[model samples]
Target: MELINQTRASLIDYVCAQIATFFPDGADTKAAITRNFAEAMGRVEKCFGAIRPWPAGKFNYLQSAQYCLFLYYLANTIWRNDDDSGTATRLFLLNKTLNGIDLFYEIQMPDIFVLGHSSGIVLAKATYGNYLVLHQHCTVGRNYEVAPVLGEGVVMYPGSSVIGRCRVGDHSVISIGTQVVNRDTPGNCTIYQGDGGELAVRPAGRNLIEEIFRV
Candidate 1:
């Protein structure tokens, strides 16, 4: 997927402009903002490569929501390290308002944590894997102080959750409404809700990432 395009360039410029509003009239501040914007743009582009033609239009609801979520992550990263406290605070508030997800947790942006929508998702401070695709209403949170360590190519369907100190292996699927707590799952498996609301784990029927994404 082409990451650098006219639309993406415009989107970057738009976000930079919004960020600049919080900075004061000084050359040093301007330079810092420029550097931060470049870094954020690079990370966001790298992570969102599978979803090409980003910064979608208003009508493209799903893509647009994803775009907003990406912006939130980028802003959160910048807010963490930037010296301008006021700018950081403004961006943090903006991110929370747009995505409605808790920003108190840490997110490793190198791995593409693909969010299907901006609503009904809560992510805690967990070790997320590469190509993590999370549908709406999914939650990956902590149990007490420990969080799940997810492997590559993990997909959590709508209403599914993997909470507590669990280890979800690569290519594992958490089926819709399946809740996995404090369990270790093997690679290439699926966790689904069985009879009587009991959760069952089995080998995955397909490689969902291979079918959907180029990676």
Candidate 2:
């Protein structure tokens, strides 16, 4: 499913990714994280779109054809990382085309993403829905503790880890430098690590107006 304010989210996500690359604790710099993500993603999309092979101004961003082209670009990154076969690659496109994305652990797939300098990587019985993002050195493995079911638009930050059987809801943002194990999280919530493997959730309907950083 497409996220609410997907463009904004995508943009912010990209920026956050960049900062994370440079700074281990970038997410703590909330304002920089927010600003960079939006700008970087927007530029990549715009620049890439301009360079794509379009005939005589026929490339309309709203059109299905154009959208697929962009998705293909993004999907290619994952494909290359997993060393996926052509057939597997096509299947990914098909899934992305039909369902936006469905990289669940149980789903038939060959190419899984692994970022560089990212080790200790693992995932089992996890359903990685579409637009899934992973930064360097994150892990998704199961413990006798919990198995994870990742929803669409799920992101894992560097040094952040998850293990056990739990569900991470759609459009959920996993905070950088956070580690989660056997935690059930709500949709569209910003995730943070607290003491004892617990998470701090900022739910949508909940007010952030007071800067009520719950401990």
Candidate 3:
């Protein structure tokens, strides 16, 4: 999706302000922090182009919260180096308390992914695809040492999980309340819990990311 350029600078400045809050006494760190913030904002702008106005307007409260949470994590994980552990921890805890986004547990962001909501979501250090949308109450975790590998354009609806060493194909949707463990899902399909709690798959209705955002 093409981003609206008018709000980009404001958004970057806001993110830099947030990073500054964690290092009030570190004037020496300002230059490095600002540089990292710029890099993080680039990734955030690419991933969350759908949410306008940076923190978003009043009517888009959920989107605003989600964007903030994403920024917090991205700033620490994707941009800042390991030398900034103290500041990164502070930002991580703040995000967890404010947005209930538990990304501290080995979660890493994809180059471009969207969060539908910021509550009850758990992500591990798995291979996430671009244009992924994660709704509320979703989990993408590992089983022992094995992690799930998701293809591009995947969507996980509320209460859905893709666990273990499963491979989910591109354009696949994990329907609400579905749990996929140690299985492989094909591309352009939807998976749901069927009778007796069995996981089922069918052709996906449409390309949501393409249809909605034309990304």
Candidate 4:
């Protein structure tokens, strides 16, 4: 994998600089960044490599979506393995400020996932599966202290939401602007709103997950 416009050392500096802009105590996180950056980047490489055609084997700092995932990996890695809550918090805040996304470090996102347009996306600490695709303004939130469990190859389109104790099966597509609130959908289907504004499911005509990822 190639890191564009940023060498490993430069990327570390860039992240530290970005954190400093929002948090004056950024200097304390340099060690954690140096310690966890390589592992986090390896995760990024694996994710990017799984994507089709574009954004594969390349980590471009200028690309907001790629950078957003990178920050998430870094923050999550630090939080999971190190005793540096402050560092992880700074990274999470920096990512939110830069990407307009609210993915907390504690959220256990899948390893093979992609983000489209990234902004205004809020993911709660839910059960996510591999090859997950999330578009802008898409949300996976909790309702009444219960979150949804999404299976493999689930795609949440722009403005779509899944809240509460829902089981979104494998290869299911949550259609744009559709909200699945405390509902369930079987695998290999598309969940859309019917003419009467009710949730409807139908067999998916195509494998959208395959189109986006090299499954």
- In model 4, the Cα lDDT at residue 47 comes to 89
Better of 3 and 4 by lDDT: 4
**Better TM-score candidate (2, 3):** 3
* lDDT tens digits, residue span 1-215, model 1: 23433354555555556556544342233343455765666566566555433442221213556555556555556665665555455555555555665544145543466667656777787887888887778898899999899998898899989999799999999988898889878889988887875678887896788765557
RMSD of every candidate to native, in Å, equals: 4.9, 16.0, 4.8, 1.3
Question: Clashing pairs in model 4?
Answer: none
Who is ahead in lDDT, 1 or 3? 3
lDDT of 2: 0.49
Worst 10 residues of 3 by lDDT: 52-61
Q: Report every candidate's CA lDDT.
A: 0.66, 0.49, 0.68, 0.91
Q: If ranked by TM-score, best first, what sequence of candidates would result?
A: 4, 3, 1, 2
Give the per-residue Cα lDDT of candidate 2 at 51: 31
lDDT tens readout by residue for model 4, 1-215:
68897799998999888888788763678889999988999999998899995666888899888899999999999999995788988889999999999999989999999998888999999999999999999999999799999999999999999999999999999999999989999989999977776798999878888899998
How does model 4 fare in lDDT? Answer: 0.91
How well does model 3 score by local distance difference test?
A: 0.68
In Å, residue 78's CA in model 1 sits off its true spot by 1.3
Lowest summed lDDT over 10 consecutive residues: which window, candidate 4? 21-30
Q: lDDT for model 1, please.
A: 0.66
| Model 1, C-alpha of 89: deviation from truth (Å) | 4.5
TM-score for candidate 4, please give it.
Answer: 0.96
lDDT winner among the candidates?
Answer: 4
Which candidate number has the best TM-score? Answer: 4
- Candidate 4: where is the Cα deviation over 4 Å? 195-197
